[model samples]
Target chain A: MDKQMLRDTSRRISPYIHNTPIFTSHLLDDMTGAKLFFKCENFQKMGAFKMRGAVNAVLQLTKEERERGVVTHSSGNFAQALSLAAKNLDVPAYIVMPNNAPKVKKDAVVGYGGIITACEPNINAREEAAAKIVAKKGATFVHPSNDLNVILGNATVGMELLNAHPNLDMIVAPVGGGGLIAGTALSSHVFGKNCKVIGGEPLVADDAYRSLESGQIETNYSTNTVADGLRTQLGDINFPIIQQYVDHIIRVEEVEIIQAMKLLWERLKIVIEPSSAVAFAAVLKNKDYFKDKRVGIILSGGNVDLETIRFS
Target chain B: MDKQMLRDTSRRISPYIHNTPIFTSHLLDDMTGAKLFFKCENFQKMGAFKMRGAVNAVLQLTKEERERGVVTHSSGNFAQALSLAAKNLDVPAYIVMPNNAPKVKKDAVVGYGGIITACEPNINAREEAAAKIVAKKGATFVHPSNDLNVILGNATVGMELLNAHPNLDMIVAPVGGGGLIAGTALSSHVFGKNCKVIGGEPLVADDAYRSLESGQIETNYSTNTVADGLRTQLGDINFPIIQQYVDHIIRVEEVEIIQAMKLLWERLKIVIEPSSAVAFAAVLKNKDYFKDKRVGIILSGGNVDLETIRFS
Candidate 1:
């Protein structure tokens, strides 16, 4: 909630997470007419920024709670993040996933030493199963992106970026469940000098965009986005922070997201998921606003299936 | 050829090239049974270590020669490397490529501002065409991997690697016309403390291994390897260097190259061409010799067509 908490969160999570590199490309700069700094959280442990939040949440638990372990309902990067973070901290992790989740995703969670509990493929089922784990095992339950502790942890990325590039005019991130962007917004608000925050989301799953317009949380009826990470809607814990600190959200077309993802792979030569590409796509789509400006993009993750990457 | 020349080359090329990061992976260490330090030249300017050699070669030319400019015959990373290096040094570049070279390759050269001179798609014809340009225009010729100046430049990767981790037991590089490995061997001989150099070549095009065995530069009857950049035979200038200083050459199968390349893309989350994978593949293939040894692998390049990356 305060600058001191953000600083302490970073210090606490520093040993458990990577202070990922900030990369710049002259060719990308020439194309967008802006000096862009990419904070590559894709290179983070377990290949996502989610590791920061997972480690913070697990570390914040009481000794008794830590002994009991942690539980989270996730079928994406957060599952692997929590598992790895818990493994690093010498704590057990119970990951509850939908029954229909991909085997590859489940295998990665298991690979990271997570104990998997499969539930029916529904939000209610997932929460109920996680609650059962909490009740039976006395484990702590951590939300993927809605916990205050997790948001504080995610804010460290922005702190590091602003520390590296203090004069950045703007910081941009993809809006998924709003954890990253909300934390980014908080970091920029307190630590950045004259810096604004923006977020990019897929048009197919623009709940965050509509939420800002309507001044309330919104949901997508159909989660048909290629950016699988952004299909979830914002939660109460992070929505207010986004509303208060975020400047705006831009909605990009699916085609645009694919094009940006390809450019990242082809030009920057870094593997980034579609979710990470949304932020860069937003900058490319709205070049007029960002022309000749210094912008920082948080590449949120790099956990996509490489075999399925499409260039055309 | 000397330490002074290596130091001077570093100073001259530092402004024009990147001192790329060295990355390590615990999973890779476990897989190879060795502690590995990867010098990521794939992140170099123009997306390969070729930039180092190209820039060094261009800078070594006299001012009058710079005015007349540099020429090289190729259709790979060197073509783009030379063009970009020439542009950086304010020198004209004459790129003589076989007419049958891929359009995408030619486009990349032109994109870097190289003057295109189409030649017959044969070694003799390509050389004759480049020779005619050298005679008619008085342009200085730079071989892709056979010149001493370029070898000195490539040696800087080993110098930097050893500078970072001075106690490396071995340095490994993929043998492509023998420049990178030859330079690596020279670096270990001059600067390394008890460090040996090894070369990784495709079993399909294992001319370097054969040359070492035969005590003569051997050519591949069929260049059928996916490691396209490594298909050429070592020239007289670099073959002797390899023979003298290199400890041994490890030849890997095409399947092993693909496996290592996939591991790099999947676990390391970085783009690397099959050629670069040869070095890692060699490490993976020869586990007993490298087990528990501190080894440094120079990721040679990252210029691969994304449309065709495969793991099978």
Candidate 2:
């Protein structure tokens, strides 16, 4: 909610998360005509920035709540993050997942000491499964991106980036569930001298872009984007913060996202998921606007299904 | 050749090459039961450690020789490295590649301002083509890894590694044409308090391994290893240095190389070529031998043919 709270959350989760390194590529800088600094969250614990929020949320739990344990429904990085965070803190984590989730995803959660309860592949079913665990086990439910503690935890990303490179003119983050971008915006506003925060969203899943334009939260029915992580819509807890702090949201096509992802792989020599590419894609798409500017880009994650990686 | 020369080379090429960061993974350490430090030369200029040698070699040329320009015969990272290094020094680079070389390789050379001369895909043809360029253009031929200057340049990898983690019990490097390993051995012997230098080679192309035992250079008849970079035989310039200073050579199978490559991609989250994986594979295979020892592994390069990468 404030600078002190974000700093406290950062300190609370410091031991549980990595202050991921920042990488720069001269080739990329030359190609885009912009000075770019990449915050490599792909190297974060559980292979994504989700670990920051997951660890922060778990660490903030009271002794009694921690004993009862935490519950969340995610088949993505958050599941692995929460599982690992709770495991590190000696707290139990109950993860509710859709039955159709990939075996690898299930294995990863189990590998991190999470107890998984499978439900039908639907939002209602997921929420119902999580609620049953909360009710039956007296576990605390933590929303993946809509909780204050989680958002504050994610804010540490921008906090670290700004602390490392304070002269950044703008910071761009992929708008996934509005959590990362909102946190980034808050950090920029509170810590930056004049840094502006921007969001990059999939053109197909342009809920955040539309939400900013309409001054209200919006939903997307068609989530046919290669960036699977950005499919989620904005939440009430983060939307208002985004509206107040976020400068603008840029929507990029699927092709642009894939191209940016490939370039990052080729030039920066780092494995980044399509979601992380969206922010870089946004920067590439609007090179004219970002030209000659010192920009900070959050490489959100690197949790790619290697089997699905086919670069022609 | 010595500590002072290694230090001078580091300082000379400091402006041209990166003092590449060292990365570590608790997962990898736990897997091997050793404290592991990875010197990530994958992030080096031109996507490999070859840049260090190339830049150093070019910088060491006489003023007249530099004016005459430089030349090399290769279709790998060295071609690009020499090209880029020459370009950086404002010298002309004559790169002689096999006509059958990949178009991407050719394009990379041209992209770095090298003038390409294609020849037959054989050692004799490559040598003949390079010799003609030297005779006609008066260019100095810079061997990829067999020249004294290049070996001293490559030594910087070990120099920086020891300077950062001086207490390393052992330093492991992939042995190709022997420049990197020989250089590493010299640095460890001169710079480290008690560091032992080790070489990791492919079992199929185990020339360096055989050379050490036979007390003479040995050629690999079957160079069918997945580690394409390590297929070359040890050269006269580096073989003696390796024999004198390197403690041992560990030959790893192709499957082990691939497994190590995948683990690095999945855990370290960096794109490393199979050649770089060979050193890590060696460590994994001899876990008991290296148990509890502080080991440093040089990740040689990250120049992978993306189309050929299929995990399954």
Candidate 3:
């Protein structure tokens, strides 16, 4: 897609999404020796940037398709995002969540007006459940990250970031299902003057980092991470865009992610999930590379389980 | 003291303080049945509204007095605020802390360019330590909340709130040593258009409430409450102002404070100390009184010890 398409997608989803604010801290700037501008997608509708893509994808449906409604399988932020987006547009959303998914997750989906169909606790079970809904109900299936429409919708983040701070030398985001970073990469490539896009991934889930290094999509089997959102691997639709326009991917240890998250909670006073902290952790890890440079970091979401938060 | 003084304080501390943004959560509004506007002083400099008073007090000093520097006795947000404010003004800040004070609190004062003086763990000891500094080093002792300059400094919060949302039917704030609420009352009375000012106090340490009822300064012998920052009693400097302008004071139970704090962390997605939550808790407790009204709540600070934070 081109810059115009990204702009159009932004305008199309403008009514449904929030143009989240950019916050800066002089204390953080002094400590890092870099000018940092944080695009707070954590403050977005449904408390995640996924709303942008979900709203855009839902709005792109045909009149007949809209009537039939949308279907997706996610137990995380996307579940809530799609549910809310569909609710906003008066479209029915069918969510296929694993039976073992936390009750809170299920409640959140239901709270956002989503119809949840429980399946066995696995990716295969989730996909099968979603497929049945699509086949039986004629619901349009929307991939959480591997869809073109979702990427175009997610690109609005880059458009807003660049439009607000055009002099940013680099834009950094966490790699979660490769949607946000890929869309940001495409948007920056089209709209940026000299801005480079980078992705941050947990060392535990270094699929995106390995994918960039091997010049192909990569998969991970490990799910042991505080950044639960980044456990998802790169997809065929997003991998090529990432490989082409993204500068590099930085992998941070689990401790670094938690530490960055705590610092954000302590300093910025905003609640951000571990996934959002990964991008800031990457910036801290690469202090020499980012020193004295103006950098824009996307705080991807704030949908955290507060009871489970640990500072150690 | 007046609108012009409040305006001058706002301008004088403009360089040192943040004109903290006002945040609204539609979900919260829907739940509370009130159009709630949160003046997020939790995001202010030094992580509290204390910065407004601290900076204003420091800037109000004569050039010679500034050269002598400032001193305060506290183990809370004010200690950090005064130190940071003094540092920003190129003045030395002497902080007198109880020897039993947490190492973290001591470290924060030192981190903000304050010279720390350890004393016995009591109010008399803290005052004596600060008095010694004044006698020996010619430092001006800045009260955390009781002094006229600090009250005028805090009045800026009301000025900004009213300036941003002039149509607010009522403004609610927490009463801690009567600085914030008193100043807020003065500001709303001077600058607001028929706006009423209200104070929220903890039932456990309901000195302000009793003082309002008896028309005398009351003391709290037991500080067995979660809102650590609001344990102090109202002083002569601010009590009279509060008595005259503040419409009423609402006292909330400890359970309500914790519940309000959790809701803010969960829904508003911002970290606020228990003292800050008291105001919102009061609002929740008085839902019948506040329903369908345009209310502004000052989130006083975000300086909680995260490890000790327990929802239950």
Off by over 4 Å in 2: none
lDDT of model number 3: 0.92
Question: Which candidate do you rate higher for DockQ, 1 or 2?
Answer: 2
lDDT of 2 by residue, B197-300 (tens): 99899999999899899999999878898898887878998998998999999999999999999899988989999999999999999999999999999999
Tens-digit per-residue lDDT, B22-128, candidate 3: 99999899989999999999999989999999998999889999999999999999999999999998999999998989998999999999999999998899888
Q: Estimate, for each residue in A51-86, the C-alpha lDDT of model 2 and write its tens digit.
A: 999998999889999999999999898899999999
Per-residue error for B146 in candidate 3, Å, reads 0.5
> In candidate 3, what are the lDDT values of residues A98-192, reduced to their tens digit?
88999989999999999999999888888889999999999999988999899889999989999998888999999989999989998899888
Error of 2 at A210 (Å): 2.3
The models' CA-based lDDT, in order, is 0.93, 0.92, 0.92
lDDT measured at residue B149 in model 2 versus the true structure, 0 to 100: 89
B249: Cα error in model 1, Å: 0.9
Candidate 1 Cα misplacement greater than 4 A, ranges: none
Index of the highest-DockQ prediction: 2
Per-prediction interface RMSD in Å? 1.8, 1.0, 1.5
lDDT of 1 by residue, A1-312 (tens): 678989999999999889999999999999999999999999999999999999999999888889999999999999999999999888999999999999989999999999999999999999999999999999999999999989999999999999999999999999999999999999999999989999999998999999999998999877899999998889998999999999999999999999998888888888889999999999999999999999999999989887666564
The Cα error of candidate 3 at residue A225, in Å, is 1.1
